[model samples]
Structures are given as C-alpha cells and as structure tokens.
Target chain A: MAGEIKCNNCGLDNKPGAILCEVCSEPLEVTVGASVPIIASSSAAHTPASAVGIIGRACGLVVGGNVIDREFELPKDDFGFTIGRTDLDQGIIPDVDLTKFAEKVKIGQDVGYTVSRKQAIIIRRMGRLYLRAIGGAKTMIKPQNTDWKELLKDQEEEILVGSRFRFGGSEGYVIFEVV
Target chain B: MQVELTLGQRYLPITDEAEVIFLLRLLRDSQKQSADLALDLRKILDRSGSMDEPADGGLTRIQALKAAVNESLSLLRQGKDRLCIVVFDDTMKVILDPTIVGDINAIKKLIDGVRTGGSTNLSNPLRYTLEDVKPMDGSLPKIIIFTDGNVNAPSAAAEERACLELARQANRLGIPFAVFGTGIDYNEKFLKNMAEVAGHGSYFEHVKQVGAMRLRLEDEMENLKSVQDLDVRIGITAEPVVEILEAFKYVPQQLALPVSGKIVKDEFPGLDVRGQAYLIKTKVHAGKAVGDFKIATIALSWQGVAGAGVKSMNVVVNFTADEKLISPVDKTVRNTVLNTEGTKATLSGQYNRAQTLFTTSGNTGMAKKVETLAKSDEDAKRTLRTVTVTEANKGIIGKKGAK
Candidate 1:
C-alpha cells in the first residue's frame, strides 16, 4: 500500500486510495482536480498556518482590503474550498477566509461581517472550476464589461480565470486568477 | 438518402471496458430548391391561465402570442404556403384547421380573441394535429406547440404518453413536431423527451417576448422551405451482447443524445447543406485478436416525392495488440463525444463536469461558451438542451437558417 495518506483536515492517517479520511471525512485524494481541505477558516483557533498542504498549481485571490491569505493553494487530496465571512462560532475554518480581506483599508473595520458564515464553495467537479453559492446574500459574477449576474443559490456556475465574484454584494469581492 | 460512418478510433482496448464510437452522417441527394417548396405549417398554442399573465412591455403572454402568430401569418405566401392553428387548455380545439394563409385579417382576429382558461393538456392537441396533417401535399409537414404549464388533463402520465406516442406517429407520418416551453414551471424533462420521441421536432424557449417567438417561427418556416422534403427513421441493430450505448451529435449541433431501443428518428432536410452526424458509443467484448470484426449495422429508411429508399451499413472495428498499429483517433469524432457529454452535464446543472469534459476533449471554446450560459435564466439552458440535444433521439434539428 502507498505510505499512510494523511488527512489534511484532521491529520489522521487513512488507507491508501481511500477516497475520504477515516476521521474527518475530508477527501483523501484529488478527485477531478478539486482536492480536499487544506486549512480551516479563521473561525476557531487558527490550526497553525503550517497545516496548508498545497499539492498542485495554486491560484491567488486579488481583492481590495487589508491583505491576509492572497495565495490560495489546494492540498492534493482536498475536496474543495469553503469561503465565508464568519467561521468564528462554526468551529471549522473555511479554506478561503473571506474575512481575511474584510479589514477596511482606511477605517480598519471588519467588513467581512456582511457575508454569512458559509457563503459559498469553490470546487472542482469533473476537472472544471465551479462555484456553488448558498449564502443569504447570493453571489454574483461581475464580468469584465458585462452586467453582473446572480449565481442562483445551490446551483453551480462555471468560474474562470479573471472572473470577479462578488459575495453578497459586499466590499469583499474576489477576483480569482492563476498566478 | 445516404449515410456515412466514421470511427473515432479504429482499434478497441484489449481488456478494460471498451468504447467504440462511430460518427454516422446522414445526407439527402435531392436537389430541391427553396423556391419549389409549398409549405404546410401548424401551430399548437396553450391557452392555460398562466399564459394570460403579463409578459414584457405590459403585454400578456396570450397577446404576445397572438401578435407573434399574426407576424408569422404575414410571412406566409398567401396562396402558396398553408397554415393551421390549434389552441388548447384542459380541452383541445383546432381554432383554424389546415388552411391557406391569404385571409390574414380573419386569422389575426381569431388569434386575438383566443381566451385563456383551465390548465395545460397536450395529448388531445397532439393527436388532433396528427390527424389534421392530411392531404399531405408533400410539403414538409411541421407542427410546433407553445405551452407555459404542465400537462394536467386526466393525468400528466396519460397526457405525456399520448403526446409522445403521437410524436412517434408524427415521425412515421413525416410530420415534424416541436414544443416550446415558455415559463419556469413547465416540466423541462417531459417536453424535452416529447421532442426527442417526435423524431423531426424541437423543444424549449422562454416564449414570453413577442420578438423572440416571431424570429423562432420565421426561422422554422424558412427552414421548412429550404430543406429537402423527407421523413426518415434511422435505427441500429447490433449483436445482442454488444451494447448500443449513448451518442453525441457533432455536425449539425453539439448535443448529447442518449438513445433507447437502438432507434433515433432523423427527418430529412436535417442539417441540409452542413450535413448531420451522431457519434454513437458502443461497448464490445473483444479478444486479443488482431483482426477486423463487424459488430453493428445502421439502417435508414426514408420516404419522399423523389422516392422511398433504404440504406444500411455494417460497423466494423479492428482489434490490435501492437500499439503502433492503432490508427490515430479522429478529432472530430472525439470532440463530438466529449462535447456532447459536456452538454449533458451542463443540462443536468453540472457546470464543472461539463467544463472538464470540454477541456479534456480540447474544446476550450465550448468550455468558455457554457460559462455565459451558466449565468443565464433556466429558459436559455432548456432551449439549448431540447433544441440541440433532443434532435439526437428524434427531431428535425436543422441549421440556424435555411440555405
């Protein structure tokens, strides 16, 4: 068997080729390019920044706010990234912390408060980049030179490089691009 | 009629689950011109109460529909092209039987006064249109139904079965049947399936706006006049153990066509000048033998004024152990298979799956194209699904415009 595959989320060793971790249920392998959990959100005690296990080409989120985690990497076996404003009481931190970019530039306010605890998820299904929005303030795509369109709740929309995604029409918007 | 077959890969995999893809293109030898067509067109409108709701620009759906119908009536050639109108709700009624398009004012008045009532029921109208397409002047027979709600006459199942069976009858009778779903609540799957079974037909659209519906109707008429007047039933007969699996259409439009009973109807005037193709994927049990094996046969039978004829061809595949002996895969066939699967995934609301499939098949263009479609209304997606994909099972999916 391939050496004990460690779960990125729970750090438990899972059997080789097991799709999910035996303890945390986080994905154990990169299935369809959308790997598993790299790090939890900044909700509870930060699980040490060393926990981020980037396994492939990483992308960066460019936003106008107090800088935090701009470079987003995926653990080879990570399932997907859960992004939101408040993961504080949720116990688990999201892969991409929207609050990280919420600090107001001048006033120094946590503008991420406008987003829900679980605003949306960016996952790879069948080798494609997909965004599934589920927050109260529905996510909308602000395309270059095109009118902003809403991403229906629970329905997946294709996300491409250079696409600007506004979460809940808040100041915390993400422009995902391959760096 | 003629059929041409192209294979994605000439060699089959040795042991694993093997897929054999064959691209079958259908063609018509007739040189009929657009000027020679004496057209016969039918319109089936749903007068269910929902259609009376206000649409764009303060116009109710029925008013928009009447204006659209009147606009279509003006496009007719007075004494040359013929037309008919069928209005239905819980009960069915052919407001205008098959008639010439000269009396435009009377027809417009009749269309304007179409009262909205009851729920949607399609079976009766489908059956009535099938019976009314008589005196088959040899003009291409096409029936299009516009509805904004679910079938609720007696039962949804009964209505669906009646319409589907009637659609099959339309295929046999050389009548092209199409359905346009105008609202969000209409059953997308049922309408899509109905159009598929109808062979030479199409389904879907947000028929609320008068302009969109007008263009659609005009396009349909122009296509009817330009393409060859023929109806065809294309079926595949394979060895019992050899699975005749799903297919993806390539030439005419990129669509996933899941087949059943090894049969799919393709009415003539299909993809006319551009041609039509369905890349059929099949699973075959092959030994390590390095030789050619004929596994399936394609049968196509068609009837028209020129004459009726049947064409059949055997699908053959070669098995080889030598890696160098395998022929390079046909990119057209490969992309069709993948893009079709991508379209299916998109229809099922799996955008990433579709994108991955498209990218894998080297169809990055299609991958980018679907993103825009992804953000559009349900009506847009449904239109793409039924119009392009349903034609694979059985529908007359022609080019965007007449040649």
Candidate 2:
C-alpha cells in the first residue's frame, strides 16, 4: 500500500500513501489500497545494501558541549531543507529544529546560543549542496581542511562532506557529512 | 505632458572618495490628466480600545478617523475608483468589499458604524486585505492601514515580521501599502519597517492632534491621486568593487541594502510621481590602481498608469581617478545623506547624535529635532531638554522602567 507516486503535472515524486504531490500539491488519482508498480519494480531491482546506500546523507548539530545532539537525514527527493527554531503562531516550523539542542532555555529568551527562529538553509542544486544564511543573525561556515571562516548573508556557498557551519555566531555548529 | 529624468552627477573623480552619493530627480512640465485613472483603494481602520479615547473637541479618535476617511472618500472619482473598508480590533470585519465609489452614502454609513473595543491585531487584517486584492486584475492597488497601538495578539515581534512579509508580497504585486501611526503609543519602527518593505509606500506619524491626523490622511490621499505610475523600480548594476551602502526615496524611506558582494545588482522600488527623487550612497573599493573606469549603470523600469507601456531609462556614471584629482562636494547629495543619517539616528533613540548631525548639516533646526524626538522617543526628548548624560544614566539605574 506504501509506494512512490509521480505527479503527472510537475513530474515530482510523492512519498508513499501521499494523496498529493508535495512539490506541486497536485492530487494523486490512485486509490489508497492500490500498490504502485514503479516503486515495487524499483525496489525489486535494488539489493538491500544498495537500497541502504541510496538513503540520503545526514547533517547534524551539536549544542552546549554535548548538552543536546541530534541528526536529520536529508531528504533525497527534495532540493533543500531549512534549519531554525520553531514558531507555531508564525506558521514557521523549520525542517530541522536547532533549538531542540538547547537543554534549559526558555521559549523566547536568548537560548544563550543566540539561535534565530529562522536561520540557515541547506540547498541541493545543480549536483551540489549549498548552505545559505536567511536570518538576521550572523552565520559562518568553515569547510574541511580550512581554518578560515566565511560569513554568509543572503548569498550561498558550497557545502561539502565534513563541512561545518555555525548559526547565530555561537560556538555551537552543525556538521554535514555522509553517513 | 513631458517628463524629464536626470541624474545628479554624470562624471566623478574618484580619488580618496570611498563612497559616491547621488540623486535622481523626476520632473514634469505640466500635470497630466487624472481623469483616466482606475484605482482600487482599500482602507484598514483600527477599532482598538485606545481609539475610543476622546481626542480633540470631545470627539473620539475613531470619530476623527471616520471624518478623515469620509473626506478622502469624497475626493475619489465615483465611477472610476473602487473602495474597500476593513475594521479590526482583535478580530477583523470586512464592512465593504471592493465596491465602486458611487455608493458614497452607504460607505459613509458603514464608516459611522465602526465601533471600538478589543485588543489590537494588526497583521491578520493586512493578510486579509492581501488575499482580497491578490486576484484582482488591472486597477492600481493601494492599501492604507491606520493603527494607534502596538500589535497585541500573537506577540509583537511575530506580528511585525508577518506584516513586513505581507508588505513585501504586496510590493511585488505592485500594491503600495501606506501606514499611519496616530499616537506615540504605536510602534513607529514597526510601522516604518512595513512602509520601507512595501516599497511604493509612505509612513506618516501624527502625534499632535486628531486634526493633524486628518490633514496627514488628506495629504496621503492627494499623493495617491497624483501617482502616475503604480510601480517604479530602479535597477543598479555596479562593478564588483562597488557596494551600495544605503538608498532612500521621498522623505527618508530607506531601501534594504544588499547583504553580499555576489549581489552585483539591486533594485529600489517607488512610485513614479512628478518631482519625486531617489538618493543612493555607494562605496567603491578602488584600491591603489585606478585611472578611468565605468562605475555603474542605473536603469529604471515602470508601469505607467495612463495606458502607457512599460517605460525604461538608463544612466551611466563614469569615474576618472588619480592621486591628485578629487571629486567636488555635491551639496544636494550631502544634505540628503545628512537627513537620512539624522533620521536613522533618531529612530535608534540616539537623540544627541541626531541633534549633532542635524546641527552640523544645517539641514534641520533644533526645533525640528525636538519635534522628531517628541514623536519617536519621549525619554530621549527629556534627556535633550533637561538631563545631562550622567543624570540620564543615573535615572536609568534608579528607575526600573526607564527605557
């Protein structure tokens, strides 16, 4: 009953049991009980190890010297994901909650780490991943094998394996690497 | 009617000058015919508890606001112009949909029926207006929002951001949003930020009396009527070494600066009315070796309201630099910069800095500075008149709510 579905209008893949395409929001016509042939055939062609390998790489954040740590597996189907603190009233619930790493911070107070409600975003475009700063606070990125820090604003920079980026100009940073 | 567009400086010697500031002024030979304009005007009136307080001559603030709205409605061309009215407190009620201005009596009656009571929720009504206007085609769109208190529900910061984002969306759709803050209690920064982000809009602060508020509304209505083009965008393509530090439109409206060097181009949006001007401050990092180079090209594209097709114009600034040839000081550009800087300082509650800048620039008198302080920061005004820096600091320490 669970399988990938393709939107005929925009050609975007929808997750298993999705009634509409996530990207285009077009309704899918298939019945809920029916199985998708394309997904079944694709899974049949791949071995279990290859299937595991096909799972997307992950990016994670470490806050307060191991006070809190979490990782999110980047969506293989989507082009990008946003990381920020969540605010339900504003209808902004970022894909990755950076504040989940905070241990004892109050809701509206500066988390001592200074993370913004809407911070940096990671985008995968043109066969490469990029990190961009979209918030008011300062965000800095440091790639592997380089000690220099490059501050990001509304501009985008390439994010590669072993890349490190900090939000809100704090010591806490998130590392992106293949798992 | 003929309109002439000109730049402040066509050539400059860039020696030792890190930043170049200039003005772009638009002038018209004669006023164009206003009979053909088809405009959609939407007004959002605040019905919060504060509006019930008596303002001038025993009339409530809401009553004064209604009178102003009625006067402005009388100015609209009945058959050609469409109007919508929305009143909001913690909740919003759409009193009139986009109706032709022909039914002036009905509109006046509805305006009289707007009563005041609840807390303030500024963002939701704006969102509602956006939704109402988004799908409409072809009429010049404008929204006027009047509020007398801070955004009370859903938190102040969140609502401010939401309003700003709504303004940005409205700007992209060529809809100008003018905001009026009636009293000192309203958040001027929030209202100003909304106006700036809205691009083709103005923010007016009426702190003195209800009659002043009515006059401000009348002036804005006149401005809206005079708009020849609804959306005018100026695009600046600068050299890699050049960076635009700040930009301002009519009456010190600030444009957002580009955040990175990769952004080689930026656009400043405004309404294209006759006698309007735009000022920009840009810095060129022409390190050591510079002889003669073209710095930037400013291009303007606009949608004329009078059935004119999209019009475009371009101006280029070329610079020649040496260790000896320095650029001459331009007074208009200097005064503009000073005005913008003083306004910015006053907004940030640094009254002394604003006073010094305004005094040195000779553009603003001490009385004007005091008036600005009275509207923006009462504490800063008190510091300006009575208290020294040390006394102010001691007062801040002594009182818990001094800020």
Candidate 3:
C-alpha cells in the first residue's frame, strides 16, 4: 500500500514508499524497497530542461548549490582532466527509483548522487571479477574469513579522497547512470 | 576595504592608517630608500543631491569626483600618504577615516556609494575633520573640503563666525584646510569665508576641473608648508594711482586654478596700490582717469625659522586717459620672470637637476627645487609653490602666475 509523499526536510518530492530524499539526506515516508510509483507533479513540469547527456561510463557528480548538476565528458587518453561548467547539466532522479531498488539500476537514467572522490568501476564481465579475486587472494594470502578481502577487486586502485586529486591512478566513486 | 587617496596619487586606507603608514615606511626603507614621510590627508566631500546633478560626464558630479580621486591614487605606489574621507549631507559621515589609501578601487566604490541627496552642511564635516586628523606628533596633517554649491549653511553671519572659530582651532592645531568648489552655483563668498575660518584657503571651479584642484592640494600636503601668516596685507605706493581690481594666488594644489577670481582675496584687506598691478575697468572719476597711477605693496609678516619679521613687495598697475587701456604692473613682472632667459634658464636648470637626482637616487628633488625657487618669486612663496607644482596647483595660482 504505497502512497506518494514529499520529504519533510529539504522539500524534495519523493515517492510515498520512499524512506529518504536523494537530494538531501532527509527522511521520507516510503519504506525501502517499496513498490511505489512516483508521479511528477505539474510544478515539476516547469523544471528547466537539462542539457547534460547520460553518463555512460564513469562521470563525476557535482553537488554545488541547491540545484545539483553533473559533468559528462569522459577521460580519453592518459592526460589530466578538468570539469568545466560547459560540460554539465542539472538533473534530478525520481524518488521511486531510489526507494525501490539498490541493485539492477536502469542504464542511461539519472540517479541520486553524492560529491565523493571515489570512482565506481564498470563491471564488464565475470572474467574481470575472477581476475580481481585472484589478485586479492595472492596479495593477502594470510587473510581470515572476512568479506573485506573479497571486496578488494583487482580493478580497485588507490585513491586520495580530498578536494583535489589525480584521475587515473586513484580509484574514485564514479557515476553509473546519467540524465 | 575602502581606500581614501589623499591629494590624488597618495593612497590612504580607510581601515587602518597605521598599517598603511607601516607599509609606506617599509617601501621607502626597502625600495624608495628615502625618508618615511607619511601623508595624512583628510578630505571633506559634499554629498548633497546637487552633486548628483547630471553633467557632461557620463556619471554625476560626485561620481566624477570619485573617479578623479581614484585616478589620483594610482601614483602612490610607495609612500606614507594616508587618506581619509569625510562625507557630508546636512550632517557628516566619515566613510573612510584618515588612513593610508591602500586600495583605490575600494575607495572608488565607497565614494561611488555616496548618493547625492540633502542640504549642505560644511560645519559638521569640517568639525569632524579637525578632530579626526592627528598626525604622528611632528607629521603634517591636511584637510581638504570639496563641494558643489553654496552651504545651505545656517545664516551667513552665524556660519561665518562658526567657520572662523573652526579656522582658529585648525590654526592652533597646525592643520590647514583647503576648499574646492565644483560648480558656479556654489556660493563663493560662503566657501571663501569657510576656508578662511578653517585656517586654510578656498577655490571656485567646475567639477570637471577637480584634477587641477587635486594637484594644488597635493603640493600643500606633501611639503606641509608652515604658513607663517595668511592674509598678508599689501598697500600700494601713491604715485601711479593704479586701481587694483583683483588678485589670485597660484597654489600648486589641484584644479584648473586655485580659488577662482577673488575668493581668497576677500578675506584679506585689499591693498590699494598706485601701480600697474591695479587697473580697474571702470573709471573712478570722469576727469581723474588720466591721473598718476599708484602701486600696492603687500607687507608679509612671517614667522620664519629665524623669527618673526616682515617684508613689503610692490604691485603696480597703470591706467591711461582712457580707462579701457589700463594695464597691471604684476602682469609685466610675471611676464618678465616667465619669459626672461635668466629666470627661465635658472628654473629649467634646477628642474633638470632635480630630475637627475630623481633618476639617479630615486629622490623627489622636484619638491626641494620648488621650495627653493619660491623664495624670490613672491612673498607667499610656499603658496605660490603650491600653485606651480601640478596642473591643480597651476589653476590655483591663476594663469598669469604660471611660469
């Protein structure tokens, strides 16, 4: 019995079954994994059309000001990258998606974003997962039964989480979906 | 973040004069390698609505003044020139205290923010300025009052009395107040009186000509001349029977000319002379037109470094049987001083020498040369020196006084 609702704090419109607002960490009425349909209100229709394309690979999420936007230009070669305002667009993901599913995210769709200096690696195949397991097994051979050991995938790289950082060498949180 | 530039190029930060003074000292010690002479500039700016009146410039009169002030500050790259601003309507407001103008842009913004609206009040600002500017004991302090029109100032006699009292106070404190009137609408008589009472001098000019005024005021601020006495009385000799019309002092402070026409002269008793310097346009008497001309002599009683003493200089003017053909003797004297090869050569030589010193040792020998050249020029040597320094100074001294 899911119903539509808005988050009390931050006034972010969310699904009735949602537990929290994605924009701000405010509690919502809907519970997690609720089967609710989040309807966009008439006022939401007035939202300006965002020009930012879908983030196909890893994209950085910029949470500045009340309106959150994202930069889409991906790193091409082994050179440094800078996020320009020209490359970004404002986006908001419907609250229903956040409350319903954590895994099996819809591709090419906007999702809740956090401004963290972490990159999410695209899981292409089982072979790469297998390779990460092998690398983790060899690096910490004396590790006991801890899921933490399995978390160290071969694709995982060291990352410095601060205001400024190098792109390639560090493993930063990446955006899987873009709107 | 407001900056108040004194005498144009010298920056005076409103937030902290001591900080600016320290910075100036540091610059002089490290870069300029000269004495850490600090400039303490106290400015009284009129904020009456009249200043907001549309002018030929894109902005209003007040806006132009702000621009001029900022332009003046650009030259103070390294110096102990402190700036303070007194903004006034009917009442007075100290927007930026007499501090070193650290940032001229900031001062511009602060000045720009001064919207024009209200009656004129010269007293409050003058009073505040007199109280605010206190130099480092021996340092020189300067107070500059800028206005557009006459004081909506409380009645003439009362205002005059109050201004005189203020001048006396300023005299006691050794602070000199100089005035710059922006437009013709300004009551020259009142401003002149105020300037006299403030123990300084006043000018009447166009707002567009403020740059000239700035130059004259800056000269006075820099050297901080010890005005031994003002209102130096000059009497004419009884021979030539010359009728003096008017006289102006060419102080090298800013503006096209210092106190235009007879603004400052009214304060001093007119020295009726029998010389060529005094030639009235109208005839005194119908038959007396062809009579002998008399010359006027200004007796200057100055308290020089040596002691108190007096000196008399003659100003002669001549009138022919036809009063229309009257000529002033001072004009000839000035022309002689200006066009003469010896005087011109001596002055140019001294100027070149000063320039050489400036280039070689990075010193302001120009100021010293001016002080030296003023001695034989006139009785009010420093005042005249003020007129000779910059375009502003030239304007104060009058075009005839320029050499």
Provide chain B TM-scores across all predictions. Answer: 0.80, 0.77, 0.49
TM-score of each: 0.60, 0.57, 0.36
User: Model 2, B315-383: lDDT tens per residue?
Assistant: 344454432333234333444455455555655666666665545444333324344444544533433
Write the candidate numbers in order of decreasing lDDT. 1, 2, 3
Report the Cα lDDT for residue B143, model 3: 75
Please give the range of 10 consecutive residues that has the lowest summed lDDT in model 3 chain B: B19-28
Show pairs that collide, candidate 2: none
Q: What share of the reference contacts survives in each candidate?
A: 0.00, 0.00, 0.00
Among these predictions, the greatest DockQ belongs to 1
Cα displacement (Å) at residue B192, model 1: 2.4
After TM-score superposition, the amount by which residue B205's alpha carbon in candidate 2 deviates from its true location, in angstroms, is 3.4
The better candidate by DockQ, 1 or 3, is 1
lDDT of 3 by residue, B36-144 (tens): 2455678888888888776543666777777666666654533456778888877788888876657777877787777777877777777877765566543446677
- By summed lDDT, the worst window of 10 consecutive residues in model 1 chain B runs over B394-403
lDDT string for model 1 (B165-243, tens) is 8878876775666567676778877876676676553434444344357756865665555554255566777665467
Per-residue lDDT tens digits for candidate 1, residues A10-124, read: 8876532233345754444322221111121112343332343322345555556222344765322213446666432112234466775543432354232455555676654
| Per-model CA lDDT versus the true structure | 0.58, 0.54, 0.36
